[model samples]
Target: MALTAYEQGLLAVQRREFAAAREQLESAGDDPRAVLLLGQLAGEGLGEPVDAAKKLSLYERAAELGSAEAAYNLGAAHANEQRYKVSLDWYRRGAELGQSGALRMIGVMYATGQGVEADDVEAERFLLAAAASGDHLASFDLGTLFAYQRQDPVMAAQWFLRAAKEGSAPAWRELELLVPRLRELPAGDTRARTMLGVILAFHLDERDAGAELLEVSVAEGDPEAQRSLAFLLHDNAGLPDDKARAMVLFRTAAEAGDGYGAYNLGVAASDPHEAVRWLRQAAEAGVPESYPQLADRLSELDVDEEALRWYVRGAEDGHKECMFAAACWYRDGFGGPVDLVQALRWYLSLLEVGSGDGIHEAHKIVSKMTDDQIHEAGRLAGQILAADVLVVSRRT
Candidate 1:
């Protein structure tokens, strides 16, 4: 008995024979699974170099064959190209097929009025569906819309908590920032009090009053209050330095899922091994600041590959220092093969975003490249610019 084309293609994919899988899947024609596999192969360049136009065509065909993932891909490809109406149409189709990603995109479209009139009601409906299906970003947007647009801070906080529990760094930041705005509320809002106390103590330089307020908030059993008090006790000259108590509070805050707490613990740990563990935890929790810190430490420890990984994360999040570090790494082949094109790409990216400190280096690299390589680098840079890839992450 011979295997069917779909079955053969699937087996080939599992065996990492992408060329064979593409051939078999292409032969299977309109079979939904085959169409989807072929589209994915083209989109991801598994068998051949990526062909965006071919990938889009294949995805559209698969979508016509009723593949939800293909429909979602069509939406995403169109959205990336700023064809919002077409993207929204595809998103609606995928949403009809119960694709969570499609639902999320639809919600975003409605929220932002990309292709349709702004409709908060529709946005909420779709976002809620996506969130229920485990879309963390959808939940985050719901929190933002509720807080800012609907003026429902309590509901916004609730949604933000949902997003944070799902490991959303933006949602965590939103919740923290929302604290001070709640100050006008009754005094029973311990979280607000705790946050205000910390801000006053650490940020505004009202030390004595801040410490007093923090004590009251900590007494109310707020983990953030515990963390803030720990910072003050450790850093303030006027306050007694209680190392053991500070350590306990830091651990407590970290266990409560505060990335700052984890970061502080990572920085303060006497043992390098322990520090690495804490730093990794903080990085995984999406604290952008922690990426460079961990990368620097890893570089000091001679773990070049791990350090490069963290540097890449920081660079992706638009940290200038990390961007320069990553460019140097790519240029020198540190932790990986040297690729002049990739190095040039990073340098050009910095310049495109108005970081002229890299301009001289980029010019030097351009001089070293063949005209063809320079042209290719320029094309790559164009893609990055169109995609708005240079902006800082929510750390902004």
Candidate 2:
């Protein structure tokens, strides 16, 4: 006799056999939870091949059947596959269905252009919606975006405080970095003083004299306080190293899509593999700083292709070091065939962006060329620089 569907599912899970579980779950008919599980397993490759197409289908099916988890998974899978439009569709669907995960994912996708064109306006809209839905991750993302992207320090601090209360490590880290600056604004800034006291008690390696301050702030839904306390407990920097606590805090921050927290966790990891994994997560979340760091690390490992890719990404994001690196690569043919013209183009672009070192270095490289080569390269560089200047000015 055929195994009962429940028995098969249970056995598959017990044996770490996700494929079999998926097969049985699908065959068992319209159980939304089972379908969602199947989609997750297939999509994540817990068993079976990492089949994006199949995973998308399963997630879509389960989502249509009213599984919020399925919809969220579908959006993530679509983004993973670089199907940004489809990802947006699923994310919007799940957000409308009140799935916090999907709402946060939508905000991230919009912020980073995972599946759709990057649009800060859309990102803020989705993130605010998710925050209103009581999603901690959304609150964290909103805080960071306002702080860094919008340069609205006040709003950023407010959001960070909110996320910290929810136990977000990144929020705490950000608070630690920002509190000193906030203190300089003016007197009568009770919010800044109170927040600082709580943070100091939780993280300053001082006696816990103001521990109750942290407790009160956390209880009041101040995300920064929660994050600071969590970071202090997890890192044990002033206490003791608690890997378990660190893992929990890191996971919470990562799930909230906090780039800095993810990047920090990656850096603290034991090996390059884990570092790259977390760095990629942070990079995908729109941390432009991650691109150059990842590129440098990968270059050190001689992973030239990946390094070059990240270097280019960093350059596109206005990282001067990355542009210099790329220019060097093109000139030296590190990862591909040498292309003098490309090298010249990159160097001149750097110069246009007011890089003195880049201009001096570029002059040295071009000086070695024949007269005709120099003229041609100069003409091309001029054109590209003009175009870049126009683009930058438009954005500004």
Candidate 3:
């Protein structure tokens, strides 16, 4: 079948045969698609020297030929040139022709009052309309509007999360910006203070500021705040170094049924039996960190069988230390009978989770294993890594 000139031009562009693409597009005649492509090529200087006047002329011709994208391009060009009112009119034309990006620009213009009166209502309406039409950047703008103008962190967080779920990198920046404004929420809402403190300490690295926020929640008997503040105080990062106070806070939070606090208190306990008891509770409470910690402490107490069980669980959960320990135990027959294949497989598994330590250790013992065993281990590790990559890709 003979291809249309427009389609042939597209094929030429894909192959980087820019001159042929331009000729083919020109020969396509009155097709707005071809005209738009020609204007884009001119604007991008694809097949010739950069000519702003030529690009603008081509865009104007394309826009006259009913190309919504050309209208949008003209809007962007005018906006970049500081022709705000002209850009707004072009953007409105694009929006009238059903361009979500144009709608987003109109919302931004109204929000900033660049070429229109500042109207939060209009900004919210247009931004929401664009966002609901699958414009992810508009979701980010809506988040900023709520965060900066409305001063509503709760609403801002929702919009930012939506943008983030749609893969907007700026959405995370908006989340960070909202953290400061979260302080304005009512102090009676300990949940807000707890969240604010956690973000400040961990995400922003403002430990002292985070501690102050956490103190407010702690005074209101918030266990989560107690745990976070305790972790900061015990982190050994020059933040007052009050291990005793941290220990008390950990104990307080642990007794209130905080799994992370229990895990920390278990680590800090002097007696092995007490540590094991608290760690067991933490593990039962579904704390992933407790798995590796409990395994190590149990191994110290010479409880190899139970320790190996926790190490295997943690290894499956992608804990590097547990993977190392599990491999070593299987190789040395410390917890059970020697199984070089299991050790090799666990060692290879570490590479999937972004570590090379397991493979490094595997090299020493691969000589002791059969060729078939090594092959099987490599196959299993490859399958696990592929599955993990697929899951991560789906998330982004």
Candidate 4:
């Protein structure tokens, strides 16, 4: 009867009936499997808003009863909620019990100072444990840490290669970018083919090799690698810059929802008519870079209203250039009516982000205005610059 109840809950989950699944699973007793299923259902919100509290409760219960999956899930949920100290505790417990994912999470927390004081040596120790256990994600994290955080490119390359061999698509892509420098190393001899495969897949101008590697990765369901190779073949970035081929690759990557691929395709279209089409597609897909470029392109075409709208979008998306451009337009009435107050606000915002051009232009504009306006602008700029100086000092 209990098994039937659990099976029914699973079926309800499959059919997206969250309420029914939760009801059924709750009655399935304290079985670890049932609790895990219930927690996942609550966490994902198949039919309700995510109840993180409930999910955490269920996972904690199951974990206390010795379910490895539950322990890992509990730790992850805590980490996501930024309860880092609690997450570290759960992760350490799970890691001690031989959970590779937990070990990796602990490593990341130590490295990032999420809940604990950052300790690179401890992070590396935990990461090495996870890597030795064949955790591909852990290996990738370690590689990225060495490459970007620690500035140890040699160790970074080695960990990246290990992760790539373990089928980490991002690591493979990053390795493609790093391989040129890696080849200069004496130890690169043994990794020639793997490096070559990444190059052919992402950076080389040889379609045959790129296409072959792409096809293999695609068949193997490596989305990022497939997208990279497709881009190379389609843009002739790998072969000879063929627009037709690039369009095909762009279409494929776009369909698969690759954000950068969609943005690149939008940029490559060149036709103002098609620019809006691809740019809108990429923007809707959450590519922030697409908004500013689309605004600039529209401005070039003299489509002022559309351009201004996209500029606002770009500004909202935190593009410094777009903010400066929009501020100028507002100051001079280029696309819409002039509004000095709005222009000043936007310029000040841009200055906050360290846009020298925006700050200079804003100062020049204010200088020509009434003496009162000049004083106000100067005061605002001084405040912003003071804050920036404080931030820089803290970092140092």
Candidate 5:
């Protein structure tokens, strides 16, 4: 039997032949999966360049054919652009079909009152349902709701622990901060108990108790406790100075993949090169501030190539200042040969992000370019924009 156009489209998609996929999918006429796939390709900025209007049209058709994912995607698109009421409507449609992400988003809307009244009960109900359906965001949202809105530390701790088990870094961060309050809970949670003891000892001037508790936690390899103890020892506000031990603690935290710990180590490095080394580690570990700092330091040292590299890194991570700096470097030939096309690409990327004060500068550069060069710049800019969209969509 001849394969259906939809099946052919799927095969094309699997082979990364997006244009063929689009052609086959479009020919599949009224098939929900085909429409959905086409919508995703256009909307996601993945295989095809972004075409927001085309995406919406295809998604609408797919949703009309009972595609829950299409409904959810519409909800997400509107939500991202802050069209909350429209987002809520689309989310409700998906949620009615038992979509976990839609349910989770509806819970968030209730929690934040973005498109509805703030209702913790409703939020909890929807989030619990979504969580039960295997939505990790629901777990994180539950943690935030209990911790922040409800002010129920014990409940928050429970959800946060659940989220942490699912690899949530924010959950772990919250758990660390909530340590002091966790002491009010029963003694069953040993980690919380340990953290509370350390907090009391350090903050309440119970140095001996803090030290003992911290020693236990540190021995158990608690990175948060290690970081806290490092700061306490380094500051020596209420205890004896132990700079060497503090340094060791920082190293331990950095080695354990803690971004802030790496940042602290970078700040403490006496040698400029050593500082850059640590700062690079921090930046790569997801510390946003470290990117600009590293780039600035490299610039000061006249290491234009490395500075541009760092600036580009930060720019790709959505740092506006770094985007401008990178574009400037590209345009002025500071780091390498002047590449007006690449510079134009960065400048257009900045404008697309809705930040760049360099619009006039970009225009000036365009004025200097030939017609063909300007057209090439626009083409490169589209690629950059589409690539950025794909990155953000995947991450979110």
Candidate 6:
């Protein structure tokens, strides 16, 4: 028995014989599927010169012959050319034929106000309809809309999980970032709960799980992960003998110039000289907590000048406690001088961050300073807070 023209065309396409496929498809009379496939082959330049006009013609012919897929292709092509209104017409045709992709695009258009008014209600309706038919992109878009436009983290996590299970990588990544910010995980959703557990177990407080996740990074000589795993192991994650291995990891990380590793090694050092050396290196490497540790040690030894410098470093790095310490040092003349303006500046900065009871102390500084010095402190505080505000705005 011999195959029909349309069957022969499909077999040739599957066999990578584009020239043969096109010939057979062109002769597959009255078959809209054949015409649509021919248009796709032409658009993709499969054994033929790419022809946009020819592709559009064939798609229109196929759509006129009642092909829902051809209507979708027409809508997508017009969308690529930025003819939103025209694309909407074709998209509506596909939607009328119950095409999930067309429904998703119509929802997107509503969401973005492309060919119509930005209507969240309509967008949600269309998107939910598409999602009911198992469109993965519709699920992902729903997650994005909820997470960003609606400010609904719980709903966002639910949709992202659905898209991820449907194999959307972007949805998986978005879900991971959103999980930590969620105060409550979705109820009765094992997948969502599992994702939250995986994040907490792999990235946060579970020592054994953290070690498991960090194994490859540590083996590949990643100083940061190595240091982190070693720190957790040092806390004895149910293994007393792990302390010896933790020390070895700390040493390795320190040798690779990891600041936390140096800080940890310094904390465990018996000799004062070696401890001070490692602590200094940790401070110089810009470890935020190391500043307070090194500064407190210096202050205990009456090394006020060096202690003040370390405190200021931590304060400038946005550590709230260090900002308070720095302000106090300036106010009390512990490090250099009783510079009222500098003290007021640090106190105002601390107050802006809501970290210290700097208001009472600021009042003291205000009483001691001249009116001109008070103005200077206010301006300096504005400049400092402005930079922080810009950083926070970008993150949000």
Segments of candidate 4 deviating more than 4 angstroms: 1-211, 218-226, 234-243, 300-303, 316-320, 334-336, 346-355, 367-396
**Stretches > 4 Å off in candidate 1:** 1-221, 232-235, 238-247, 269-271, 383-396
Q: Which numbered prediction scores highest in TM-score against the true structure? A: 1
Give the per-residue lDDT digits (tens) of candidate 3, residues 1-396: 234687667657766789999999999998887888887787788888887888888888888888889889999999999899999999998888888999999999999998888999899998988987768799889988988888778677768766876788887677687775786788787877777777678667788898998999888889989988888888775656477789889989999999988999898788998999899989989788899889888989999999999999999878888988999999999889998878877888887788888756776776675555665565555533322222234346
Winner on TM-score between 2 and 6 is 6
Error of 3 at 168 (Å): 11
**Which stretches of model 5 miss by more than 4 angstroms?**
1-58, 62-139, 142-181, 184-190, 193-216, 231-246, 297-306, 348-356, 370-396
Number of the top lDDT candidate? 3
lDDT of 2 by residue, 115-217 (tens): 6788889889989988877687888899888877787656677788778877898897887776667657554544554466555665454536444454455
Better of 2 and 5 by lDDT: 5
Taking the tens digit of each residue's C-alpha lDDT, what string does model 6 give over 146-192? Answer: 88878777678768867876688898678667866563654444333
Clashes of 1: 0
Would you list the clashing residue pairs of candidate 5? none
Clashing pairs in 3: none
Residue 351 displacement (Å), model 1? 1.8
What is the lDDT, from 0 to 100, of the residue 318 in candidate 6?
66
Candidate 2 versus the native: TM-score?
0.45
How do the residues 208-237 of candidate 1 rate in per-residue lDDT, one tens digit apiece? 877888788777877778888888788745
> Once all C-alphas are superposed, what RMSD does model 2 give against the true structure?
20.8
* lDDT over C-alpha atoms for residue 286 of model 4: 68
Per-model C-alpha RMSD: 12.3, 20.8, 13.2, 18.9, 12.5, 24.6
TM-score per candidate: 0.55, 0.45, 0.52, 0.45, 0.51, 0.47
lDDT of 1 at 29: 75
Model 5 is weakest, by summed lDDT over 10 consecutive residues, at: 383-392
lDDT of each: 0.77, 0.70, 0.82, 0.70, 0.78, 0.76
Cα displacement (Å) at residue 136, model 6: 1.5
The parts of candidate 3 lying over 4 Å away from their true place are: 1-172, 235-241, 359-369, 383-396
